[model samples]
Target chain A: MKAETRRLTRKSDHTRQRILDAAASTLANRGYAGTSIKAIADSIDMQDASLYYHFESKDALVLEVLRTGVVLSEEAVNAAVSALGEQPDPIDALRAAIVAHAEAVLGMGDYPRANVRNFGQLPQEIVSAQMSHQRRYGKVWRNLIEAAMASGRLRQDMNTRAMRMLILGALNWAPEWYKPRGELSPGDVGRQMAAMIIEGLLATGAAQPVRRQKQGNGR
Target chain B: MKAETRRLTRKSDHTRQRILDAAASTLANRGYAGTSIKAIADSIDMQDASLYYHFESKDALVLEVLRTGVVLSEEAVNAAVSALGEQPDPIDALRAAIVAHAEAVLGMGDYPRANVRNFGQLPQEIVSAQMSHQRRYGKVWRNLIEAAMASGRLRQDMNTRAMRMLILGALNWAPEWYKPRGELSPGDVGRQMAAMIIEGLLATGAAQPVRRQKQGNGR
Candidate 1:
């Protein structure tokens, strides 16, 4: 009996995965407004009624797609944070987090665009679940920022919230312009983005001269 | 005779403006894919055939809408750059330019989104023209980065191309999430964006301390 139950669980999981794959492909091709339940059903070679058996509505299918995408992103952030556990430096932690985020978004490709397009259409309960997921993801970066600030690696006066928004805004919008066929890979772009934010355009030594003035004045 | 010519020109201009206004509203409401010539004409209380008197086809009408939007954006950018005439400080010039840009986009509201969505659907020539306008507008920011590097204001080793992309990417994508109804005005968001890019997250003094050891350390 236990063996039969385990086999049934595996079958259920496989069917659910197939449905999600079909949903993502349909969403990417047809967009939110263009896609329909019949199209998703046909893609998987299932009767339209079967999709209803699995999902309550087209919105439910979309919610499943979004949940899958968000979960993947959350995993990437967790992995990056875990990898940074070995590093003692706060800057390294921050850098790792940014790199992980860029990779996650690029890997997901059209999923993020679909998320942005369908955000308003999502049911309140689903939207709340997604928001909670986002808030948790955000805390990872915030923790890194706070660590950096506490360690004097980043400036205390730096508004962490605003910085977080800027970093996220840039990374999230990258898919619109980033082409895989282009010269830079997503990983390269991610590193470049992190470096630009961390170091900025000012020469490393240029600010030192200004800093000496305060010390000299004190002396 | 001059009065007759003036009246003819005024009527033509008014008709053109009316068609563009109708097209913008239609595109925003129905999206680029769903919008039709008849729908635009209906919005303006005209027959579909009457639309052809002003525009050659649906594509032409859409192109005209985009063209008008781009021209307005170009004028705004030009005005901003002109305001910064002979300013030696690149950071200040960049700030002023961003403020002007944010004001123009916020004032235009849904027009920019419509422009971005319909970009691929536009005729190649129209797309080229819009790109040319954008490239020219981008030069203002590029030139500021060059000037900052030429002066001692910014680090000479920094990647100006990447820096420009970073700043412009953050600024351009603001229309997606920024609500004018919020506590932050468009102008305020623009200023904050510039500050985030220019000043960076590190305390000004803290960034300079490590610069000497990391000169030419491009990622």
Candidate 2:
């Protein structure tokens, strides 16, 4: 009886995964406000009633889709980090993680794209869940940045939050202009992005803010 | 007779500006696919038919709105550049341009927001026109980055296009997370972003591409 239950659970999980894939594509193409439950169900050739057995409502389904996007995104970043192995240079790990992240978010995938596109349109309940996921993602990057700083591989006095945002912001915006066959692939763009950010943060000499002080107004 | 014609033209231009402002807000909120001529006209308390007198079609109206966005964006960049005055430092000019851009994009205004939101969904003719405007915007940024490089203020080997994209991409993405009452204002965010990017590219002594080489693959 236990074996039979385990089999059933596996099948159910497979079906849920299938639904998420279909929903992500639909949501990416049509957005939150334009997509309907009927359309999502139709994409998977599943009945609306059956879909409800798995998901309580459209919001429930969308929330899962967003969760999947964040999960997949984290997995890519992890893979990039793992490539560094034990005792890796923190700055190098950051570059690999950022490049993988750029590829995952900017390449031919629907989940991350949908998350960035429909973030503003999701229902309140779903939004809370997405925001929590986003916060977790932010923390991961912050830790990487802190590790880099601790290792003296980057500027020691940098603000992690601002630096993380600047890096992720550029990566997230890649889909806006990232042509598949264009001169730069997502990976190439990622490397370039990582280089530029890391170069700026190098503490060749102890860094200071570069904003020009008004000569006449010096107090 | 010439004076009378000039007065009529001024009145017509005023009405056109009014229509574009309404359309920009509507499009920003509802997106290009979700918005309609009737919606924009309703926003301004004007009939859809009369709206046609000012814009030949929805495409024409959207095109004009985009033009206004580009023009306003250029003006903001120009203001930032002018602040540096004659004999400006390249890095300082870049910083000022980025800060101004961040404020314009992430501020209370809706035209630039509408442009980014509705860019993909615009009609083909409108998109072609938008592309040209975008290209011009790219040139302005490229010029700043190139000037920085020429002055040895930034890394000489870095691709100007990539650097420009990284700077502009982060600035453009600010609207996603920039809260008016947040810890940092849009201008402040812009400055931080500039410092981050510019710092990464500083040509101090020797620099290395911050990427991890695969272990056991000794070069």
Best by TM-score: 2
Once fitted onto the true fold, the runs of candidate 2 whose alpha carbons sit more than 4 angstroms away are A1-23, A34-61, A86-88, A121-125, A149-158, A201-219, B1-19, B34-60, B121-125, B150-153, B201-219
Tens digits of per-residue lDDT for model 1, A52-128: 65666777778768776666766776787787667657777777777777777665655554554443334466678
Candidate 2 residue A123 Cα shift, in angstroms, is 4.7
Clashes of each: 2, 4
**Per-residue CA lDDT of candidate 1, range B18-65, in tens?**
878878876654555567778877877889887776666677777667
Candidate 1 lDDT for residue A110: 50
TM-score of each: 0.71, 0.74
Model 1 lDDT, residue B95, Cα: 64
Reproduced native contacts, each prediction: 0.34, 0.40
Across residues A40-151, which tens digit of lDDT does each residue of candidate 2 receive?
8888888877887676778878887888788888888988899789978887788888888887877748898777776554556677867888888878898998887677
Q: Report the Cα lDDT for candidate 1.
A: 0.64
